[model samples]
Target: MKIILILVLFNLQSGSEVITAEFDDARACDLAALRTFQGVTAEPDMRPLDPAEGASAIEGTVIAHDSDGAEIGMYSCNPSRSDRREG
Candidate 1:
């Protein structure tokens, strides 16, 4: 199954932004998230979203910190199946 990483950035003042990337599997998606977190000094907090019928997803919140170690913004990454074509 293919996995797509959906990233949503939530900013209180401005708004929210979404970014997506496709991967071959969930492991690759999760690794990409981890690598992204490493770049911005973020704290990773992961939780599983409620599954819908036959679908399952894992969502994680990344808290970004400024250079002085202050909270800047937060974003979530959810990995799920990307192939939606019916068999």
Candidate 2:
């Protein structure tokens, strides 16, 4: 039981990642370039769209890291285009 508990705790304290939306054209381009971070830059997998699509959105992943590099949380980044407009 002790070993099982330890394993469970270890799994709970791990770093994780998430897919998010980023509409920043410039930032999107930078991420798309994948040149600045030695290929660590994640690319946005555009969601499929249809004629009925209301707005265009880009999907990006967010990597959440724990203190010791242990994935603790994972989530998506849906960065609204407001920041881009401000810049």
Leading candidate by TM-score: 1
In candidate 1, list every pair of residues with a backbone clash: none
Question: After superposing candidate 2, which stretches have Cα over 4 Å from the reference?
Answer: 1-58, 79-87
Q: State TM-scores per candidate.
A: 0.49, 0.24
Name the 10 consecutive residues with the lowest summed lDDT in model 1.
72-81
Q: Candidate 1: list runs displaced more than 4 Å.
A: 49-87
Best by lDDT: 1
Residue 56 in candidate 2, Cα distance off native in Å: 19
lDDT per residue, candidate 1, 1-87, as tens digits? 666766655456777666678787767877786566555555544433444699744455455555565544444444454456658
Q: Per model, state how many residue pairs clash.
A: 0, 12
lDDT of 1: 0.58
